[model samples]
Target chain A: MNQLNSTQLETLRNDLKARGLSLFVLKDELLDHICCLIELEMEKGISFDEGRQIVFKNFNSAEMLRNQKKTKWIYQSKKFKRKFKSVLSAAAVIMLMMVGGVEAQETPDGHPIYGDCELASGFGIRRDPIYKIKRMHSGIDFKAKAGTPVVATADGTVLEAVSNPDGYGNKIIISHSGEYKTLFGHLSGFNVKTGDKVRKGDIIGYVGSSGRSSAPHLHYEILQGDKKINPELFISK
Target chain B: MYSKELMKGTLKTIVLKLLKEHEKMYGYEITQKVKDLTQDKIQLTEGALYPTLHKLESLGYVYTEKKEYNGRTRKYYLLTESGQAEATEKINEFAEFVLTMKFIFNSKLAAE
Candidate 1:
């Protein structure tokens, strides 16, 4: 298995680009993978062209990667779409149900719930004890006495921290890596402001009944983009 | 050989869970690891592995760092915070699935 000459590697890059595998990261990754596979095959007495063919064959359809067709594959028939959606959603539901049983719940890469607080409410729709009407609660509320320090659930850059705000009287929103954004709502005071970088358990505010609420609580929400998933999905209680 | 169709649904979960246990891994290392663990019975073709890893990267569950090793560039994958939580959840769920399969299989064996 000879190392691919720079000229051959260049040709492969152009071929891949012409086939719609253009993202540098994706291209480099695939290039390395294919080169390695080809080397293995060539070591077994196959020529480079034959090795390349075998590699492409194992991938099933390098031709299908051609730019325009890549789009088509994603937006194809409704039948394909339906089947794909069911498989993904099934996995999601299973993930949610199986979380609490393991010690891996510590989430080695993420920060734990900050500043010790008790759960006032969990996520989901419920009869609002305050307004006496059914309402969808987008986040979990932790019972913290007024002025108890509220901390960031994970490391991130503060998106906003409002003081004496309306509706949500005091709120702090922090955006973390990996598409995560956390909101600490109805605070008594602000310790961090917009654009401030914070770490896990960093004090960002104080608990209070500042917003439209009935008691001193920290309204904690974890969002992936704008989608509000259950916070309990990620953090252990 | 393992059924490719059966392997399809679990590949992402497997990759995420793998990265969770190790600090970082390159593309070929993951394939070799899976194959070794499964005793060559479950070779992950790059076709199956890379797309899944790329999808996970795009979704921000995992991210990559590139380094030069022995005159070649290798891309190492690591779990982001979200990826860590996701891997935990996915692995737990997969364990439950395998257990359920075993239970069903045992009952059928007894009945037979």
Candidate 2:
């Protein structure tokens, strides 16, 4: 079998690129796959172009080329979407988990509000409505009527659902993959219990003035590990 | 040629078992290895092979190691620690599935 010289390989690369095999890793693998196919064909005593013809006839489907993009996007996006549940035993080896980690970003579906809602207040320090003192707001507050259904921001397990007196009146915390936790505060009621599985946009409770609140609203907090970061980093008005 | 449906259902398990036995392999090597072992009866097309490999990689079951081969960079897939464990599970699952298939298919009429 004749080996494909560098010029022949380069020409093949351009041929594939012209046909939309531009995804780097896939293009590289296809280059190798095509080379192997051509070599195998040549082993049968066929000429180089004849072997190339066979490879092109087989691999040059529009559907196959479309897969180059679709698979790349799915892999790239899911690479960022962490689901530690399936294989937590090997999480330690995933370096991406160490750096980027799982984060609460804009969920690709309906927002946490069930019907009508607006941002009453956002993440950052502001003057306490009643106390009139500047204090840090740990989460974003959505203004909604009491008993407005509140959905989960992402897929997670209900971590806690309790009415505490000290602060955060009736609250529900859901633990997501990659150590992401979302807190829903001032709920009038809960639709989920601790350890219950919830999906993105799944209604977990009803908004209310339950905990340390002056009005009916939803206090949404996104926590990385345990630290409360800006909910706006992920959600918005 | 094998039915695409059967191949689709079995491909992940097959790829996982192959990776478990081979330790590491490039895309071409994997296709070639499977063809050789199965006597070309189960030829895996590029369309099927790549999407499966990418899905596995995204699932954290496999990781990539890039190496320059024949003046071009080739991405080699190596099973992660969890991937190896998953491979064993997949193999056993497929075995059980086959057994279940036998029980279902081999059952004769009760003469009712």
Using TM-score, give the best candidate's number: 2
Give the per-residue lDDT digits (tens) of candidate 2, residues A117-211. 99889888999887899999998899999999999888878889988855789999888876578888989999999989898888899999986
lDDT of 2 by residue, B9-104 (tens): 989998999999987898889888999999999888888889899989888899989887787778899999999999999999999999998877
Q: Each model's C-alpha lDDT? A: 0.76, 0.83
DockQ metric, candidate 2: 0.38
Model 1, stretches more than 4 Å misplaced?
A18-20, A23-25, A45-50, A62-237, B68-73
- Candidate 2: the clashing residue pairs are A169-A211
Model 1 share of native interface contacts: 0.17
Off by over 4 Å in 2: A79-237, B109-112
The candidate maximizing DockQ is 2
User: For model 2, what is the alpha-carbon lDDT of residue B69?
Assistant: 72
Give per-residue lDDT, candidate 2, residue B54.
91
Q: How well is each residue in B2-105 modelled by candidate 1, as lDDT tens digits?
A: 68788988888889878988999988889989988889988887656776776677567888899864345679999999999999999999999999999999
Instruction: Work out the TM-score per prediction.
Output: 0.46, 0.55
True C-alpha contacts between chains kept, each model in order: 0.17, 0.55
